[model samples]
Target: MRTLAAIVLICTATAPQAHPHIFIDTGLTAIVDDAGALQAVKVTWAYDAFYSLLITEDYGLDPDGNAVLTPDEEAQLRGFDMQWIEGFDGDLVARLDGGSLELSRPRDVTLVMREGRLVTTHVRDVAGTPAMAGHILSMKPFDPTYYTSYDVTMNVRVQGLEGCAIVRNLPDLDAGMQQLQGALTKLGRDQDAIEEGFPEVGEAFATEVEITCADR
Candidate 1:
């Protein structure tokens, strides 16, 4: 069967957007530290992807400021908190039904770059969004802790991603399960997950993403 690269990313860098958005990169290095009672993490970042897709819209801005939208696109953006954050838990719970899925709350995440590498940053205070909810169910969770951050590991196995999986030699949903297990460990611990998949650019199935965390 044909399968495509899974886990796509289409995010682009611009000035600080009004709505909540985070940075993604591979050029980064992080230091594990303690913030009083809470876990504190510092990160350096590497963002080099040409473009990125916004899972949600920047509702805070007006139509003129926004890139513009079609009737259908506008409808999708109409209801919801419409920020980088998930509008509701149902978004996640719904995905759990089909394939395997898991979410986590880690102590802290940071960007790190040892020796000489690109800037890679961790997804701090972030939650996982569905790549292709229609094709696969069960996504790697996007934690509120990394709500405004990026991650290197992204989850798949949702109904939405079936399109890509069908067109390319992608890993089976079984692999998606293995990825979920790793994300669980990352939630509360100061660990890193660099889940591999396709970037969301050329193909339609490249919608989900997990930006990496590393040092420049």
Candidate 2:
């Protein structure tokens, strides 16, 4: 009977373990105009932290108006605080990905896009009821030495986080890799995939995602 019990346990766990963690959700499309310009791109997302992508696609000029980009505009776009939850514990993905991305939360975040500047308000942590930041950031290509990958080049500016603690990137990314929580399909980073081609995330906007700050 001991052998039988062990076998039963194996069977029960096998199915869930065998499944790949790649998640697909509600918003996952790239809408294009007659000119093949990406008008709207959305993705169904699950935030785990392993190099996972929401819905991403190629972006081009819009027919309604020229997609006015700054001279500094690079190839990729990056966002944090979403799937970045895995690097943290107890914390959860919260507001900001509002509208288009179906959520159980009843709040909304206001994004201010003017000329070439963008600011967001009403962003709050899922565990509480407060706005998320006074942070400001600017991102550009991480490197110009080479042009190979499709990785997101981001510049993270942490002004005031939940605790108002020091907003900083952990020096050891791999050591803290275990902090991520998600469906398992979302827990890994692939530099190659970032450089190659993603059906969701578009081309390599920069070399690697970069975070910048004054060590606050």
Candidate 3:
């Protein structure tokens, strides 16, 4: 399991930057059935090079430092990030009509080292088949505590659905920063933000993807 403490320590020692200790380039694919009902979503995450290095080192893999893992090493590295603790939401939020959509745990997980970065993919099945003809579906990936930042830099697409358009909504960074600063100010300079309970404002800085389909 990847603990927050371990990630914080690694980031503090390596980067020394405040909040957003790690960065991931994210990709999301919404899956739909023939009836245009949402079925699942495939998520892909590519870790930043620095964080990838730390993970490789921590796992004692890639001893050659060539970023190439043997088949056995690859097997060992599989699911390194999917060991979710209780209550962890896998950093994904999906909603329809202002109501939260329940997603199953990650499955069909694949991990590999690509160009010195750790890239992983997983599939999360939606609880119920919700038709997308007349409704809008929104999805975002983020860590609530802002310990890790996720950017939807890769592809966002809908499969098995026609006339569905995907739109990427970029976050307002200026506003998000202002909100963070305000929350930090409330904590005071002398107080440890983490110990004082850092505010969950990650969604304020997240990129949301919206999917809508034309009437059939």
TM-score per prediction, in order, is 0.21, 0.21, 0.88
lDDT of 2 at 191: 28
RMSD of each: 19.3, 18.6, 5.0
Kindly report which residue stretches of model 3 are placed more than 4 angstroms away from their true locations once superposed. 1-17, 188-190
* Clashes per model (N, Cα, C within 3 A): 82, 15, 0
| Candidate 1 weakest lDDT stretch, 10 residues | 1-10
Clashing pairs in 3: none
lDDT against the true structure, per candidate, is 0.27, 0.25, 0.83
Score candidate 1 by lDDT: 0.27
What is candidate 1's CA lDDT for residue 185? Answer: 34
Supply the TM-score for candidate 3.
Answer: 0.88
Compared with the true structure, what per-residue lDDT tens digits does model 3 show for residues 8-44? 3454442222576688989999898988889999999
Error of 3 at 84 (Å): 0.8
Q: Candidate 1 has what TM-score? A: 0.21
Model 1 per-residue lDDT tens digits across residues 81-182: 212344443122122235433333232333222222223223232234323322322122222322222332322211111223311122343443334333
Best by TM-score: 3
Give one digit per residue, the lDDT tens place, for model 2 in 59-119: 3322233333333332223232233333332111112213112122312333222332232
Candidate number with greatest lDDT: 3
